[model samples]
Target: MSKLLKDYLAKSLQDKKDRGLYNEIQILDGANGPMIQIEGQELVNLSSNNYLGLATDDRLIKASQTAADQYGVGAGAVRTINGTQRIHQELEEAIAKFKGTEAAIAFQSGFNCNMGAISAVMDKNDAILSDELNHASIIDGCRLSGAKIIRIKHSDMADLRAKAKEASESGLYNKIMYITDGVFSMDGDVAKLPEIVEIAKEFDLITYVDDAHGSGVMGQGAGTVKHFGLAKEIDFQIGTLSKAIGVVGGYVAGSKDLIDWLKVAARPFLFSTSLTPSDAAAAKEAITIMTQSTELNEKLWQNAAYLKEKLAALGFNTGHSETPITPVIVGDENLTQKFTKRLYEEGVYAKSIVFPTVPLGTGRLRNMPTAAHTQAMLDQAVDAYEKVGRELGII
Candidate 1:
């Protein structure tokens, strides 16, 4: 390696450490469920995105194993080649059905789905209006498209409408696309899709929603777009198979023409290897299970409400979240990290979000309560929160 490159890497890492922005990853000894073991210490985990706790579901595991037995492991090629197996097509069909769309196309991961989908449809001649707090993947995807990017205020409908009107009237671009997260991962705020759809209709703009954190947790497991009854109105409904679906992959569900265009124009689908046989089969089974029953989704909301009530009653700012994601706000970044460490020591494993991920002064401990978590686990978590919070003078 070059000495200059090595020095630059060292300085950048040190700068991150000084700013308390460096993340120290934790290792889980087993599956990411309600409870997890890290460094031989079992803790009530609240940091994972496994909202419905489907990651370790026996049915999903069995489906994956069965697929492995039948088709081996990997898909062996990209979707345009021999990689497009029966399971892949079936999963895509399942996604379309679940999302209430005309068709769907799958990718290896949600990030790639965003990277491929946005670039596939919009280009330098286009303009994308994105939410200020949208996920990194969406931002990167927009950049990749070489479009003129306009950032709208987070959940501010007025700002969106004004921007939409201004951009449309300017007529500087061939097309304008409005994109947002169905559920903002950091604050757990649901996007105003109904209003967004209305604005899109009024301005004749293309609509896209990245429902990565919304699938299996909203709209009776359909997603946030369906939560507001705008499934058919939105042009693109993007989601992930890795989160509540409990597998690995991402997809875009939309009209038949949109999906056909994605299949041919999306570079990831055309170039990257498709999801492995087990992952695809497991994802399909998971979606089927969700469509068949809302038991898991209900439990997820129940746990979320319970935890939020407990934390807020204890005087912690739970933030303005409408979904199962609970954020315990701590203003100082260093203190937030310390609070997380203290909670871990007391047997709860919730991580702190700081700058670049969220606004600098709004550092928080984000808790993700899942369907598999029990009352006892929640009570124990509350106890740990109280103890650590009181000790740190945060509550």
Candidate 2:
């Protein structure tokens, strides 16, 4: 390696370690479920995005296997170039129906979906009003679009209205769009969609919602947009199949014209290989299950409520989360890492999130209580938290 490159790498890695911003990725020996094995130690997992525990569902697994057997392993090429399979169309149709949209288009992943979709529509001649705490993908997509990006305060409807009005009235851009996470991932607070819709109507701003963490967990499994009856109000509805759907990929559900445009213009769909046959089939089946039953969603809410109540009773600052994501803010980055290490020692695999994922000095242990986790498992995790919190003086 070049000496300059090696020195830069060494300095950067050391800086992260010194600042306690370095995260060590753990390898799961088995499937990601309510519980996981790390380095031979079995621990209750509270760090997955699989909100419905569908990642390990028998039905999805069987669907995946069947598709693999019938369609082979991969789609073989880009969607526009002979890779669009019958299963892909079916999955998009299921997504469209689930989202109550006239049409939908599948993508390789949620990040890629954002990257392609945003840039496909907006450009330097336009402006985007984005929530400050939106996912990195949204931020990158907005940047890639070359749109003048204006950041809005997190869920502050007044701030959003002001910004939307400012941008729309400025007469500096051809198009003005507003984008936010349907459900904020880090703190679990939901977007104020009703007020946003009202403001958008007043300003005539195009709307986009990234519901990565809300799908299958909100609106009896439809999504946040559906939860508030804003399906027809919002212009763009985005969801990740990898989240509650327990599969791997993403989709954008919208009017047939929007989808038709995306099919021809989205760079990722036009260039990247299509989602594998097994993944597409499994995702479609997962959506079907979510549509058929609310049992899993109910259980997920129940477990989350129970976990949040227990954690609060134990004196941990869980913030204002409206969903199943429970974040125990530890304030200091190194201390948060130490707290999670203690939890791991006590048989809980709660991970620490810090720095770029959130603001500095707000390091936290982000716990995900899924539908698959039983009260018994939750109790066990809380027991571990209690022990660790007391030992670490966090309680």
**Which candidate gets the maximum lDDT versus the true structure?**
2
Q: What's the TM-score of each model vs. the native? A: 0.99, 0.99
lDDT of 1: 0.94
Residue 144 lDDT (model 2): 97
Model 2, 242-296: lDDT tens digits are 9899989999999999999999999999999999999999999999998888999
Q: Which stretches of candidate 2 lie over 4 Å from their true place?
A: none
Clashes of each: 0, 0
Q: What is the Cα-based TM-score of model 1?
A: 0.99
